[model samples]
Target chain A: MNFQPYRSPSTGRPVRAVLFDTFGTVVDWRTGVAREVAAFAAAHGHTLDADAFADHWRALYQPAMDAIRSGQRGFTKLDTLHRENLDAALRHHGINPDQFSRETLEELNKSWHRLPPWPDSVEGLAAIRRHYIVGPLSNGNTSLLLDMARDAGLPWDVIIGSDMTGTYKPLPQAYLRTAEFLDLEPGEVMLAAAHNSDLQAAREAGLATAFVARPTEHGPGQAVDLAPEGDWNLVASSIPGLADRLGA
Target chain B: MNFQPYRSPSTGRPVRAVLFDTFGTVVDWRTGVAREVAAFAAAHGHTLDADAFADHWRALYQPAMDAIRSGQRGFTKLDTLHRENLDAALRHHGINPDQFSRETLEELNKSWHRLPPWPDSVEGLAAIRRHYIVGPLSNGNTSLLLDMARDAGLPWDVIIGSDMTGTYKPLPQAYLRTAEFLDLEPGEVMLAAAHNSDLQAAREAGLATAFVARPTEHGPGQAVDLAPEGDWNLVASSIPGLADRLGA
Candidate 1:
């Protein structure tokens, strides 16, 4: 595939770092979560539509974060949010919350930390890291990101997440604070995400933006975010494609 | 040389993460700084005792941090502190600040970010990382630690430093906050350092501690911290020695 390097028309400063959106961009969370949930359900002699359970649990992610982002609740780690959402999802699915031991439930909640990286994530990140600082700028808390990195062998130069900034994606504070913490101008950091909305927010925060399509991020027949929504600085189909375009 | 693992007498919990003290424990900052300063002076046709200059600059480190730790000043990144100390050192050494351009001075101040790790730092960290998450919990800021890790090829699974906590070491907050952020009990995390004072503070904070003696951390003929002053959970002569004792 032919790849074209991106240049910021506004500042033209070279990109020094690539801050990624973690979930669908780097890891196949939907598949990973569904697999773990199915295994857990089988072990506990419970019948569950694991795929639906995974989707339902993820559907609660944004609302949980919205509570903190909208100031309705104080900042809480994504791990806490996941546990609460997991319990609610279990209850909603007609599974008695008491059916699983506390330790089993806690282990299941950490499914996020056990996610495997997308096929191209590790190699592409290694390529990018040779030329630029690369890390996740995601809603996952510091521990979550760190655990995922270690589990998946993701070579992140740094880890930046909403937990550090106490705000969720699309919030100006998240993008701005990430760049500030890295001691880089927003223009010097590019947000490479599978979600157009995340790139849009990053662009508004003065960061360079790239869109990498994850056509089946929500599994087969997934709709939305399959194409770039705006005139992103770079658009690619995979992380390696992004790496090539970035000359990494 | 023979090595023995030291077990914690207090909690006896297995270690999950090893937080390092970066400057003296991981990197030879004194030799690195002196070498860079000497090179810069020769390039600028200046004559100076680089060894004494490095020592004098380091001598100001504790007092500068003390100001912030004592609440006399707001939290400041170590980069800022290093730059301020660099200017003071330059002036004190009878060099006109104008002799070098702003960029030159700025580059020189970043010598800290380019310090060479001790011979065992890379290998030892890699070994420890196999069994436990290993990262620096130091006074250095995030960017500084990131740069040094990249330059020195340190395979840190995570990076946690005073920048994240807005406090310096020997303070309970630094150790406590790091554990809180990692979502681990203090007893589950070990603070590995070359200074007994740091290990003492970690112990008091209810965290496990390991003392790795950097006998020449302050350069040859240095006094104090040459031996373990307290019954730290583990004590070793080098990072690799520490790793061996920890069974990593």
Candidate 2:
């Protein structure tokens, strides 16, 4: 890939750090989660629509965070939130949570930790890391991100979890506080995400933004974030392409 | 080197994460800062005792952090603290801060970020990383640690900065909060340091401890932390030796 150095238009400075939104951006979470669900159902001697099951579980993600973002509840790590949603997801599938041992349920909950990265994630991140600090600015807890990085071979220079920021994405603190943690001006940091909404929030929070399209993130019926909704600083179809554009 | 797997005597669990004290432990801060001081002095046509200057600056480290630890001051990042101490050190050496430009002073203050790692730091860390997560749990702030890791080729899986914990080392939170961030029990995390006082505090906080001696850290006349003072879980002469004892 040809290299083109990236500079933030907002500050006219070369980017120093590039953070990523992990789920559905760097990793194919839907497919990975569905694969786990299929194995889980087969082991339990039950039939489940794995794809729909994965979607159903993910659907609860926002509402759970919405409660925290709205200050209706205190901040909580995504792992705990995912566990609670897992029970709800089970009941929605007409299965009782009590049927599974605590150990089994806990293992199933860890599907997020074993997610497979997109084909280009590891190589692209390794490339970008040669020139810039690379890490995940994800809603995942520190352990979840660490496990995924170890399992998926994501060559992250660092890991920034929502637990570290005490908040989730779309909140200004999540982006701004992360920049502070790195001792960087917001403009020196770029957030590359597949979701247009995440990019929009990041831009508003003073970070440079890059939109990486993941049209199949929702398994072909994806209706949102298909293209950059705002004038993102950079736009690319894949993580490798983003790295190329960044001259890494 | 013979390999021996380490298990915490307190919990009998295999260590999952190994964090180290960066200054004077993983890196020779005194030599590094002195090297930069000599260069800066030569550039400015001034003669200074570089080694004594380094020791004088370092002598102020604990007193600065103690003020914050005692709640006499709010938590501050090490960069700012280091910059403040640099001015004091300059005045103590009969040099005025006004003799240098703001940029020059700022660059000199970053000498800590460019410290040279010990011969065993990179290889030992990479070996240990194959089996466990590795990082620096130093009083250095996030940016300082990130800069040093990049410059020294330190393969950190994560960075737990003093700023991240809102406190400095020897404080219980510095040790406990780091374990909490990695979702590991204190017993599952080990702190490797050249200082027995640091290991002693970590042990009191329920963490496993390893003493890696840097007997010349304070120049050949170093008298403190020459040997393990407490019954640390593991003791080695160097980081690679520490890795051998961990069976990595």
Candidate 3:
């Protein structure tokens, strides 16, 4: 069996395009959004379910992203998806329908863009960016990804969000689409992710995988993808370290 | 007459997306490609008419881009467009058909990808990237743009080349389609360039215009677009200064 390795020719290194798993890789949503939710609740003088709401919102991600992938629904941006989730959250909180204006809903939806970058994220991406073209192959739609980039000062060479592919990550189509968008073969792109499952999937599609452990991606004590499993092409402790290892 | 200002919120400081005029704005196609043509001819031990070929090939751009835009031809990428031009040039140059293989011709077509970046391009873009979602909205196809970005180290957040929009710049739909593809309102995107005609058309169509004077865009002794002609939002001596003025 011939195994195809995704490597860059510049340094005889594996991978040219480092496609990131955005939600948990670059930014921490749990704590960031939880605090905002709590504060928004507090400002409203209401005791509401912040954690549950956050979990509900995150839970809807796949199903919503799947709608497009399955061809059940037309393409929709993440902002609209977040809006759909927020409207239900508001209803669950028993808030009066007329209490909040469309402006309020818009601002709340923007919270996703405000999530704080991981301690190593900004510095890490900057370092990787010097040598390789780093972009997010995220489930986040283009608008959401673009907004997040603006809010967090993420210096991405391109935005390979799901909106472009009309499919979510873990699908070979999604990975292939990123490579195609970058005008590279699948073997030329490396999926630099914090999740083992994402790596496993990209590997199956012949994309090189680099694991940057985000032990706290799901929050402390979560322990998901705490280590690389199977045979990943490269593994690094952090994004900057990954950059160094990749000759960035 | 009240002049409507061009600004896109998707890009906060100015517009979310700033479309560029490719031929002269992003790449110095005439000089760049002519230089490559000269080198290729020398390597092949043939007297290639570099200047004649460059002019003849460029003359095919508008009709080709327009054909796609007008649906006279289905969406053909710039690679295909360039290859078609090469075929025509090869016939005109009376080059022997057996002299080059199909793959060789394809590789030669990629000469456009290696176009040299203008002196201030990288730094100016680095500065501009601080604020805008920089990408070329040229008649060049996505794959061509992608390779160009990688080869020249151009930092583009998206590659809205001709193939994606099914048209070329200077066409209202090309600029309009770019904003729509990014899911941005026309008012939220800016068309930044050195061409007055491009800026004028963009301004007319509700896109903000930023003019970065490329005094030698038409090569030395060029007298066009010496200064801002249509009251563009910002006029600067260089791309970096444009970045600074935009406070990117």
Restricting to chain A, the TM-score for each candidate equals 0.96, 0.97, 0.87
Fnat per candidate: 0.67, 0.83, 0.50
Candidate that would win on TM-score: 2
For candidate 1, the TM-score of chain A alone versus the native chain A is: 0.96
lDDT of the structure predicted as candidate 3: 0.76
Model 1, span B1-248: residue lDDT tens: 34333346776777788989999999999999999999998998889999899999998899999999999999999999999999899999998887778899999999999999998999999988888889998999999999999999999887876778879988999999889888888998999999888889999999898999888878889898989999888888888888888887
Residue by residue across A13-124, what tens digits does model 1's lDDT show? 7788998999999999999999999998898888989989999999999999898889999998899999999999999888987877899999999999999899999999
Error of 2 at B177 (Å): 0.4
How close to the true structure is residue B23 of candidate 2, measured as C-alpha lDDT? 99
lDDT of 2 at A137: 87
Task: Tell how far residue B218 is off in model 2, in angstroms.
Answer: 1.3
Task: Please identify model 2 stretches exceeding 4 Å from their true place.
Answer: A1-5, B1-5
- What DockQ does each listed candidate score? 0.74, 0.84, 0.49
* Structure candidate 1, residue pairs in collision: none
Scored by DockQ, the top model is: 2
**Considering lDDT, where higher is better, how would the candidates rank from best to worst?**
2, 1, 3
| Candidate 2 chain B least-lDDT 10 residues | B1-10
TM-scores, all models, native as reference: 0.96, 0.97, 0.85
lDDT of 2 by residue, B79-114 (tens): 999999999999998889897999999999999999
lDDT of each: 0.89, 0.92, 0.76
TM-score of chain B of each: 0.95, 0.97, 0.86
